[model samples]
Target: MAAATVLEVPGGPDGVREVRVSSPERLMWPADGITKLDLAEYFIAVADPFLRAVGGRPVTLQRFPEGIEGEEFYNKNPPKGLPEWARTVMCTYPSGRRHHQLVIDEVATAIWAAQMNTVTFHPWPVRAEQPDNPDELRIDLDPQPGRTFTDAVEAAYALREVLGELGLTAWPKTSGNRGVHVYARVSPTHEFLDVRHGVIGVARELERRLPDLVTTAWWKEERGERVFVDFNQACRDRTIASAYSPRPLAGAPVSTPVTWDELRDVDPRELTIRTVADLVRQRGDAWEGIDDPAHVGDVANAIALWDKDVHERGLGELNFPPDYPKMPGEPPRVQPSKRRKDREDGDYLAPKAERDAAWGLPVIPPVSPMLAKPVKAIPEGDYLYEPKWDGFRSIVFRSGDTVEIGSRNEKPMTRYFPEVVEAVRASLPEKCVVDGEIVVIGPTGDRLDFELLQQRIHPAASRVRKLSVETPAHFVAFDLLALGDDDLTERPFGERRALLEEALEGVEAPIHLTRATDDPAVAKEWFHQFEGAGLDGIIAKPRDLTYQPDRRVMLKVKHERTADCVVAGYRTHKSGDDAIGSVLLGLYTADGTLMSVGVIGAFPMARRRELFEELQPLVTTFDDHPWAWAEQEAGTRTPRSSEQSRWAAGKDLSFTPLRPERVVEVRYDHMEGVRFRHTAQFVRWRPDRDPESCTYEQLEEPVSFDLADVLGADR
Candidate 1:
């Protein structure tokens, strides 16, 4: 029997409860026959390359939970007494001095039933490689601790200044406690070492500028009489809870967001998920559409927005963390007598783990065996061949009349495809489970546009229904994993296909049987045919393979290329010596429009300097173009080339705003929607070519990367 639990809904029962999960395992792969190694490889494939590009230091991957059922989570323990075998403790906050116990069995039960792979569990600490404590730097001023919010606002400004010099953009997030979590996004070009060093540099600079008021020390013993800049928080694996993540400690788990002005008066505790909606309606989310890095460039601009001189010139104060680590040359910190009894008098860690464990948490053993096997190409004629449609790969489970859809990441995908429900109800066989590709198709032909497919994945149900009317979906099912309560994962591919065909014989609309071929050459040819037809690509599968859940038995082939782009301009610099200002990017638009695609300056100093001089005069600030070449005539907010690089200022301030000029031929691997998904490289410049010729029409209509289909029905 599970222990009883208490649940508090944020903003009342009307509030949203953000779910936070920590998953060290690679559970993001497809559920059908994927090995643990394959999953690890998936992450390594994505993350390791980014790590290597940033100087090859090890950085732990911290992924938050997405799209989980609300009922599947709980906060308070059951009203009934906890299980006798359970170990429980009441957790408390350092400031509020409040407490709560474990014994939350209902939340645990939901998690177990849902098979949620990710949770907000802290990874095992990295001992030696951890970041420096806040106590390491000298102390600063600002007597206002928990006073009017203005004190915090001033502190934020001061901290931003310190971060700016380090070439880091401090993105401010209200902690929903007290204080803020300032995030700085760096190019994946730096590993843990660079991140830690960069964090320290920022902290040290803050300490240097405000030694009397701000302390960069971590040890509480040494952080007396000064506000501490908690530097240890910068450890590579340490992740500040992202927006939408639930915090059990809060009265109601609230995710935090803020406006620059509100920072001065807003109390962190006041921003629970419940209160957030109303605030959002009133002020609007400042961070809306902020996920795309290309749109915002980097955090460098955010740092530049901070007003620093106002903070240094005025009377402001900062309150240091209670348990701040000791710093150099400072006497050990001693807590004020009034606060001694309030500290360390309650339980916190125990209840969090216990409440989570009491509900029979689903334990997933790492799939080391799957990793041991090398990924191989689908053997000749042993598998099925189908064009990999450009859409999300979903595994549909139908138990009786209940149907659920899941993404490759094991997340609830049903919300994004409500229209698929109608098709399943009309066509799917009774008590059956099937695997297939869900693609959005146009009115004319077999060619599927990924942009159209992506449009169907909206969060709103009404919008999805509308889109379904405009562009209906096609379920190209290739495998039958279960029928009439029998798990057929162990069945061979040939048998599964036979079973699938029998099951879907009378399916009504939208759901169609996927075409498969035995010949490898035919399969290869189909790849091009499908591609030319505007479909993604094709997958070749071995016919005799069994359905192994979570194992990679398929291969993906994508049609991709790379292209070189000339450096345009850069944003402001961060705090480090090798810090980059901004790398302005350019590409020719259709009808000879020289549109600015975005910024890209994640390069070493030498590269940055060389590019800056070459492109300086091109900076023109016409009313028609706010960003490009702005400030040629002075009296502009845009920084001058001299400020960008000493060698480039005054060297022909007037740049030839050439008529959509400068041509460079380059290759790109993949195109997402209308833009290159990754950074376009610098290929050789085409000086002899006319710039007008480099129109947006020259950009490819994005090739298809049908990865899902490539990993066919082999595992």
Candidate 2:
């Protein structure tokens, strides 16, 4: 069925425009093939700097019926059979609901959204007739999990010197993936909650002058590995990813728009969707007159540095986006074991001046954040599970030879792992403390590769002693918390795993000993064999409870299940596509083909936009979707793609195809073949199931287990 093609695009100031473009060499980027007529000749070769950075605003599109691995969605109206020069508006939402949306304004509304499969473009920082005042104050920057992408390009050059001391003029870009957005042209005379508290007073003055490389947390479990800043993307129906849009990842990248001297040899995955219309015709619109306002002052000078960090330096207001609404001094959205079962069961003390203000030269308090709680089955008795390590929890103190290593906000990361503070000061007992993690490994060992354990959090101490001797980090330990000269935080947990196995006996070579067991069928078969060594799962506890530091009588469990998938493609729904942000699920393959098995986004947000308006009329975008995306091509590659290696090796995938006629089911718990090694959970929408009886043989084989007798093997 792949035959419908029609073209003659480029018609804006009104010229040619014939556009039917149905399957014009379809592909969309079957890994570097780029078609739908090369994403409509890249918006007709950067239609005037992509309509001067999303023309009259209100936009939202991001669709991808079946390219860039297919199945993407988000239209914000004007989609059904839209054409008369595409436009719409109404909007509103923060759940105060309202609708309509779409506005783009030119290149025939991005070639009528490249003939309905829009690839990327999410405008709206207000404009579409003052949608609540905002003239773009954006920021984004993101990069959490022990951060990287050169730590959001050094927190975007320290947020471009705090938006040049609050006069404003940023503009950066490349959030095609791996963070970095920036923006800045404000003055719509305030509101969108005052440009989100002037981006939370320039992200708390760049987290008080890069305090250990910036963070504005807003949850991801208190963003520990830095570079966050996101300041509710100026709230009022928050939107971003627009400057020349196109980021459904896998090298169809292009959240382009750079400069500040093309960021040290820029390469935002070479801004694509086919070279961002020759990178905006060889760099001309570095946000040309991006709303040109010229302001060396007023965003009320970053809301007077967030009103001097909320009335004189106790810096408040953060943690939003849990689908907004509840804000205003937000601090207690529970967790910390339900805020320590509403406090009062003693033994917490610690706040030594907030652990000497989390180490901006204060010292002494060495341990706190021990939290945990993220359950879901596997807790029917006794406990003591252990194993979890995906890197960096630390604690580790020592006394008579003074060792340190803290973190979880007690900071002093003993100068970034000096061989894990000289192997916990030559294996404990001259006064100790333990609780561990730290990791890195991977030279075949593989426990933590939080991107090579964030290259030992560098600020160059000889690049953290040359990445602690070329990739060497190790810790492990696992809860002992003060051993010699007691203080085992009110004991129990089978006596801190028997004094963390007698303080790691001869803990030499970067310290290790962290196993545990009270058998829950060997902790559910070492929680699916510690995801082949890069762990992050089993931590049950309760062997008579106690050690409650940052509370949450431990729990964790991990690996969940459910799988039927096949929905394919979804994104854009934080108040736009009416709801989605995840779907891409495909499966089939007993050679007949269909593959891609990962994507479900924990749905249940009141059945997420009514399950994309119940799969938006079973959207198919090609032979043509051939029984639900098969006759190869939405980023082709298979004979079961050489038996999937937990993906990502020249990956570049996308999703969105359904006409095999509905089938969903979801629940998952590590699969590996057609993907889903995590996130599956939806569990419904079957329409009497049968997307080819959802194949890959109903997936269940993940039993063989081993963690070498649960970590007792230094083998």
What's each prediction's TM-score?
A: 0.39, 0.25
lDDT of each: 0.46, 0.69
Clashes of each: 100, 24
The model with the greatest TM-score is 1
- Give residue 136's error in model 2 in angstroms: 5.3
lDDT of 2 by residue, 1-715 (tens): 2565666766545676776777777677777777777777778777888888778788778788777675687766456556756666656555443445678777766876876778887888877888777776888888887676678887788888888877787878878888888887776788787678888888877888888888786666766788888888778766887877677667688888888788756878877776667656765778777665564235888888888878887877765565555556666554453467646523444323333333222113444655777878667588777777767787766766777787776677788778777766666666766777787765555334566776578766988998888997878777775666565666677887776776576565567787777778877767777776657578888878766455454778777656675665565455456777677677877876776666677654456778778777877675556433353444564322333333345443344455656677887656543466556777678877767778878776654434334455541
- For candidate 2, the per-residue lDDT at 228 reads 81
- Candidate 1 local lDDT, 314-353, one digit each (tens): 3212222333222222232343443454445232222322
Top candidate on lDDT is 2
